[model samples]
Target: MQAFIGASLLSSSAAQPKRKPFEIYDRRLQGFTLRVQSTGVRSYYARFGRNRRVVLGKVGTLAPEEARERCQKVLGHFAHGRHPLHGIGGTDAITLGMFIADTYTTWVKASRPRTAANTLEKLHRLFRTWYPEPLTAITLERIESWKARRLNAGRSAATVLRDLFTLSSVLRRAVTVGELTENPVRRVDKPRIDRRGKVRFLDQAEESRLRDALKARDEEMQKLRTAANERRQKRHKELLPRLTHFGDHLTPALLLSMNTGLRRGEVLKLRWACVDFDRRLLTVEGRNAKNRQTRHVPLNEEAMSALQRWREQSGSRRRLFDVATGFRTAWEKLLKRATITRFRWHDLRHHFASRLVQHGVPLNTVRDLLGHSSVAMSLRYAHLAPDQRREAVAKLNEKPLLALTMRLQWDGFPAGSHYRIDSMVEREGLEPSTPAL
Candidate 1:
C-alpha cells in the first residue's frame, strides 16, 4: 500500500508524510531500495533499484491518489513476477529494419495520398541511428537527443518532428497491439512553417494581365492553325489526319486547367462522361480525387464551350485530349510561349480560386467546391475573401448609380425622394436625393 500526502501552494517536502525520500523497504529476493530523488525536477521520485535508480513522476504532477495508484500498479507488476521499474522482458526485441517495414506495409494498405510512403522514406534514411535496440528501450530522452542532434546538423525541426511522428505513431500502434508498453513520440511539437508557406496568387490586375496575354496568344494560335491547315492542304494527305500546330495544342490545355480549376492529376484523368454538357457540370468522382472523394464543378459558358470544342476535335464523349500522356510537356511549351517561367501546374488551381474570389465567391463555398477537410485548410484562400466582398460592391452596377444621379439632377427626385414616395420627409427621415429601391 502507498501513503498519501496533502498538497499546498507552499507545498514542500516538509509538509508531507515520509519515511525517507523514496524510502524502499526490501521484502523481496536479491534486494530493493526505494528512495525519492529529483528526476531533473522538483517533484519527488520514488526510486526502487539497487544500481539503477528508476524515476517515477513529479511529486505534484500526480496527486496523492494517483501516486498511490501508480505505486500499486508497479507493485502488481512485481507481484506477477515482473520487474517493477523497467521490464519483465515480454516484448519481442524486433529489429528496426523489421519494424519499419511492417509500419510501411500497414500504412500503404490503410493510409495513403503518398504521405505514408514519404514518411517511411525518412525513417529508412534515419534507420542506422536508432535500430536494433528493443523498441521499448527507446526512451523520450533518446528521441529528444536524436532530434536535437538532427537540428544541430542543419536539418529542419519540422522535418525531424514529422519523421519522429511517423516512427513514433507506428510504435504506439505496436503498443496498442500488445507489442510494446509505451509511446515515445507523444507530445512532440512540430516545427512552425515560415509565413505558413505563403504565395501571392494572381490579384485582379495580375489576372487581367494574364487574361490579356492569353487573348493575344489565342489570336496568334488562330493564325498559326490557319497556316498549318493551309500547309496540310497543300501537302494533300501526306500524313495522319493533320495534327494541330503546337501553339493550338498548348494554349487550350493551359486555358482549360486555369479555367476549370481541376488538379493536374484530375485533369489528366478527366473522361468524356465526366462532363455533362446539358447541365454545364463536370462530375469528378472521389476515386480520382486526391482525398478519394468525388467533386463536381459547374462549368461557366466559356469552360463548357472549350469542352464542346475539344469533344468535337477529339471525336467523342470520352477524354477531351488525345495526346493524354503528360500535360507537363505541353505546359512547359505553353509557359515558354506565355513568358511565365516560374509557375507550376498547381498554380492553375490557385489561379482558379483567386479568380472566383475576385468575382465574389465565398471562401466557404470555394472550400466545399474544392473538398477541403477543414476551414483551417481553406484559410489559405482567406486573402481571397476580402476580394469577394470587394467584388460584391463592384457588382452593384455603379453605372446605374450614375444613371440614378443623372435622373435626380434633371427631374428633381422623380416626384419623391424616399422609397415610400408618399411618406412625409420628417416622418420617414427622408431627403431629396435618389431613393434606395
Candidate 2:
C-alpha cells in the first residue's frame, strides 16, 4: 500500500499484513518502501533498477526521517548509475571493517577454520588503519606504502608477502561477492621470496642429542606419574593407572611427525580410523590436510612402534593425539635440553626428506611421502644427494663407448679429427665413426 511513511503510519496496525509481511511504498518518494512483517517488525528498504532492494535499517533503530534521508541517498546513487554500497557518499556503502566483520569473518571461519583466527587477527592488526576506509580505497599505492613501512620496521619480505596474500584473499572474496569490481592488491607487485633459502634440519649429532633428551624426558615423566600414583594409593583414593608405555603423547607425537613427515596440524587432527595397523599405513584425511587431499603414508618400523605404544596409552579416544594447543612448551624444553639451536618442529619434516634424499631415494618418491603436491618443493633437498649425482656421472665411465674411444686413442688415432677417423674406419671395414652425410 502507498503511504507517506512516518511514525504515525509505522505505529498503526492497519498498515501491517495479517499472515505475511508487506511493503509500504512511500507516497512522496518513488521506490522507497517500508516492510512490515506479521510479527510487527518494520524495516526500511530502497528499491533500485529492476528489482534490487537495499535495506536501510529497522523501524525503532532508524527514525522515519533518517531512513528517508538514507533512502533518498541510495536512490540518488542509482539515478546517477552508481552502486549504493560502492558509492562513497551513500549510507549503505560498505567499509573494510564492515565487510570483514559482517561478511568475511563468517565465511573464513567456516571455510578455513584452521587458519581462520590467525588470518583474521593478521587482517585486523596489519590493516587496522584501513578498517574505517572503503574497500575501494585499498589501492596499489597504499599497499606499497604499507609494505615499505613494514619492511622499514624490520619485517621480512616473506612476512610482508604473507600479509599481502591474506589481504588479497579478502579482497578477492569481496570481488567474488560483487562488493568490489576488482582486487587492487592483484595489481601490486609481490615481494620476491627466496624459494631456495637454507633449510634448517637436524644433523646426526643434534638428532642423537634430541633422542637422548626425549628419552630423559620420558623417564622423568614416568617417575612423576609413579610418585603421584603411590601417593594416591597411600591416601586410600582410587589408584591412578601406572605408567607402562612412554610418558606422554609428546614423544610419540614427535616421533610420528619425524617418521611420517605429517604436518603439526595433520598430526594433532589425526584420527585412529585413519591409521591402519595391519597395512602399516597412516592416512591424512582430506579435511585435516593442508592441501585438502587425502594421502596415505607407509609407517616404517619406528613410526609403527610409536603409534602402537601411543594407542595403548590413549585407549579408545578417536584422535591419535588429542593436543588442541600443540606441544610448544614441551618441544621447547626438549630442544633446550638437547642444546639444539635454530630448529623448529617443521624442520623435522625437512629432516625426514633430507635423510631420504641422502640415502638415494628419488626426489619424486620423497615428494610423495611428504605429501607435497609437486616435486619442486622437494628440490630443496637435492644438494644432499651429491652421491646420487656422482653415481649418475660415474655410470658414464662404464659405458662401452668410453672403452672404444680409449682403444682408438691407444691405436694412434688423433683426437678431435672425426673425419679422418671415419675414413679410416670405413677403409678398415669397421662401421663409420660418424653417420654418412
Candidate 3:
C-alpha cells in the first residue's frame, strides 16, 4: 500500500483481499480510499471528517462515476452555505439519540403488534444504555460497532438477527420517507450466530400421554355438562362451570388440529360448511390458510367424532370454533389442572407431524397435510425416524405397493404396513435387496 496525497493506494490483492465499509474504520487508511468489491459493493471516502477517516456508501446500482458525482455533490453542499441535511440526526451536526428515536417513531407505527413488540424488545435489549448520548453525534462506524458488541454480549445469532432487522427496517424506512439520503444499516453485514435452537416437537409417547390427558379432561367436562344442566347455574360463578361444558368441545378442537395439522389461526376460522359429515372430510379454503392453498384434509373417525360432539353441544349454526367463546384462556387453565405442561395449543400441530414420522410416515405427505410451503420444514421431524434420516433416503425405501395394504394412521400416515414390500418380495420369490444388502 502506498500513501496517495491525503489518501492511500490499496492493492486489489491486498492482505485483507476485500474492503467493506466497517473494515475501513478499524484500519489506518489515509485521507480517502475506495473499496470496490466484485459483489458490486463500493464505498467512496476512506476518511477525513474529524481526527478519524470515515467511509461512505458501498455503491452498486449506483456506479463508481455516479458515486464520485454524488460524493462531490455532498462535499460541495457541505462547503456551501446550505445545510443539505439541516434537521437530520446522524450527520456531523446531529445527535445520535434523536436520530434513532426519530427513526423508530416515524417508521414503526403501522407495523403489527407481533412485529412491533419484537422490534421494541430488541431495541431496548440491544441498544438500551449503550447507544450514543444525546450530545454525541452518530456515525456509521458507531452503528457497525454493534457487530462486536452483540457477539461479546453473548446474544445468540437469532437475537442479533432480530436486532439488526429492527435497525435495517428503521434505516431503510428513513430513506423512503426522505429523513436520510441512505440506509447505513444495509451497508453493514449481518452477523452469523451458530447453534440456533431446534424447534421442539412431541415424541410418540408424549403425544399419546397428551391425548390421554386431553381425553380425560374431555370426559370429565362431558360428565359435568350433564350434571350441571340439571342444576342450571347461570353465566356467573356457575357461569364458568357451564363454560367448562365447553371443555368437552376442546377435544374436537385438539383432535382437529392434531389430525389436520392446520395453524391455530386457520382452526379458529373453521365453519360448519367446510365439514362434510357424510364424506367425513374438512376443507380449508386458500383464503383462510397461511399458504393460501386450499386443502381437503380427510378426517379420522376420532376427529370427525369430536366435531360431531361440538355441533351437538353448541347448537348454533354459526362458526364451528368461536375464538371469543372464552375457551382460549379456559384451555390454558385446564392444562394446568390436568398437569400437561410440555406443550402449547399450537404444538398440537407439530405433534401431528412428530407422531406421523415416528410411525414411518413420508415427510412429503406430512408436509402436504400440514400445508407447509416446502418439504424442508416438514423434514425437521427426521429426528423422529433416526433410521430414515432424510426424505430422499425415506423415498428410496418406499415401494409403490404401499397403496395396497396401508391405511390412514391416527397421526396422519398410511400406517402399520412398513413391511408390505417385505411380504410382497417373499411371495414373489425376489430378494428384499435394499434392506438385505
Candidate 4:
C-alpha cells in the first residue's frame, strides 16, 4: 500500500531515507504523489490512463501542494487526449538542418523555384555553420553577433540584410509548422542601406567607346569565322559550329539591354513566342518577370534592328542568344577593350531609363517600361530630368504673372498721369484726376 505523503514529509529530511525508487500517494490530492529513489532523491508526478505517467518536478523545486496542482492540469490534458509536450517536438529532435532540408526546402521549391534556389545558395553561403545545430540554438544574441561580423567584414548592408531576411523567413516557417517555438529573428533589427548610393550608367562618351570596341571585336570575330569555315572538314565541322562569331550574340545582347531596360535574367530567358516582330512588341511573361506581372515593351528603331539582325545572322530559333554560358568573362573583356571602368551589365538598364527620363519621358511611363512593381522604385530616375525642373521654374517668368503684378501696382491709373483716376481715387480716398477738357 502507498503511504500518504505531504509537504511536511518533503521538508523534513528525517522523514525520508535512502531507498529504492518508490511512489507515495498524496492524501491531499488524488492521483498526485511524491516519488523517492534509493539515494533519497525525490520528485513529484501524476499518473493517469492506466499506463500514463508525467513527472512534475524535483522535490524542493516544486513543493507537494504546487506539484499536486500541476498534476491536476496534467490529468486534465490526458483526459482531453492531448500530450503535455505535443506542440514541442518529440525529444526536441527538430534540428535546423532537418527543418531546412526536409521542410523549408520542399515548401519553397514547390511555391517559388527560382526564389528557393537563390535562397538556398545564400543560406549555404552564410549559415552553413549553423545548419546542423538545433533550431533553438539560433538565439537572438548569436544572430546579432553574426550580423555585426558580416558588417565588419565589409559586406554591404543590403546584402547582409538580404541574408538575414532569408534566414528569418526559414525560421518563421519553422515556427509556423511547430518545428520551432518562435523565430529569434523577430527580436532582431535589420541592417539599413545608404540611400544615396550612386546609380551607375554609361555617359555618351563611354557609350561611344564601348560601341567602337564592340565593332572592333565584331570584325575580329568575322575574320575568325571566315577562316574557320575555309578550313572545315567532316569531323572538324562539329567544332567549327561552336566557333561562331561572338559579335553575333554579344553585340545584339548589349544593344538590346541598353535599348529595352530588360533585366539580365529576363533578357536571357526571352523566347521566340514572346517576341511579336509583326506587332513590334516584346512581352515579358508574368511567370518570368521579377514582379510576376506581364509587361509589354515596345521595340525602338535600334532594339528592333538589333533583334532582326541577330535573328537573321544566328538563326537561333528558340532563345535569342546562342551563348549558353554566363556573361562575366565576355563582359569583363568588353570593358577592358573599351577602356571603360566600374560598370556592370545591369548598368545598361540604368542607361536606358536615364536616357528616357532625360529625353522628357514621364516617370510613370518609365516605371511601366521597367516593369517596376511600384512607382517609388522608378523615382530614382526622376532627378535625371533636370531640364524638366528648369522648365517648370521658367514658367514663373511668363507674362501673365508679370501683367497681374503691373495691374496691382498701377491700380488701373495711367502711368503718364500725375493724378489718380476716379475709381482709384475713390478706393484710395484721393482726389479724382481733372478732366483734360
Alpha-carbon runs more than 4 Å astray in model 1: 1-92, 110-119, 126-133, 142-165, 194-197, 203-238, 244-252, 317-325, 387-437
lDDT of 1 by residue, 185-291 (tens): 77555455553356556655655666667667667766766777778778894433323322344455666777777787777678888888888898877877887
lDDT of 4 by residue, 37-146 (tens): 88878888787766656677887777666777678776775565444323332525456775676568878999888788988888888889988787778999999999
RMSD (Cα, Å) for all candidates, in order, is: 16.6, 8.1, 17.9, 11.1
Greater TM-score among 3 and 4 belongs to: 4
**Cα lDDT listed for each candidate:** 0.60, 0.84, 0.61, 0.78
Q: What lDDT is reached at residue 407 by model 2?
A: 58
Model 4 accuracy (lDDT, Cα): 0.78
Q: In candidate 1, list every pair of residues with a backbone clash.
A: 21-36, 22-34, 22-35, 22-36, 24-34, 43-59, 272-318, 286-293, 286-294
Best-to-worst ranking by lDDT: 2, 4, 3, 1
Cα TM-score of candidate 4: 0.69
lDDT of 2 at 313: 78
Could you give candidate 2's per-residue lDDT for residues 1-437 as a string of tens digits? 78999989976876765688888899999878999888978889989777778788988899999889888887886675444655434423688887887668878999898899999999988888888887778888998898888889999989999899999989988887667888888888888888767888998899999999999988998899999988988999997766677888899999999998989888989899999999999999989887889999999999999899888877879998888779899899899999998899999999999888889899999989888899998888899889867988997766455555665666655455453464567687864243223
lDDT of 3 by residue, 1-437 (tens): 34331122233334133444233322333344565554545465534344432344454444444444444544454445222233332454433344455445534655443356667667667666644543232336877787768778887767777677776675566466445677777767777654323545665566666667776776777677767765565433343334333465567777788887878878878889999999988999887887779998889887887788688777666688776663577668766765577668887787777878888989898888888888887767766777754756778667655554433232233345455545555677864322211
Q: In angstroms, give how far residue 33 of model 3 lies from its true place.
A: 46
Judge candidate 4 at residue 89 and give its lDDT.
28
User: Model 3: runs farther than 4 Å from truth?
Assistant: 1-155, 178-199, 233-249, 273-296, 325-341, 389-437
Best by TM-score: 2
Model with the higher TM-score, candidate 2 or 4? 2
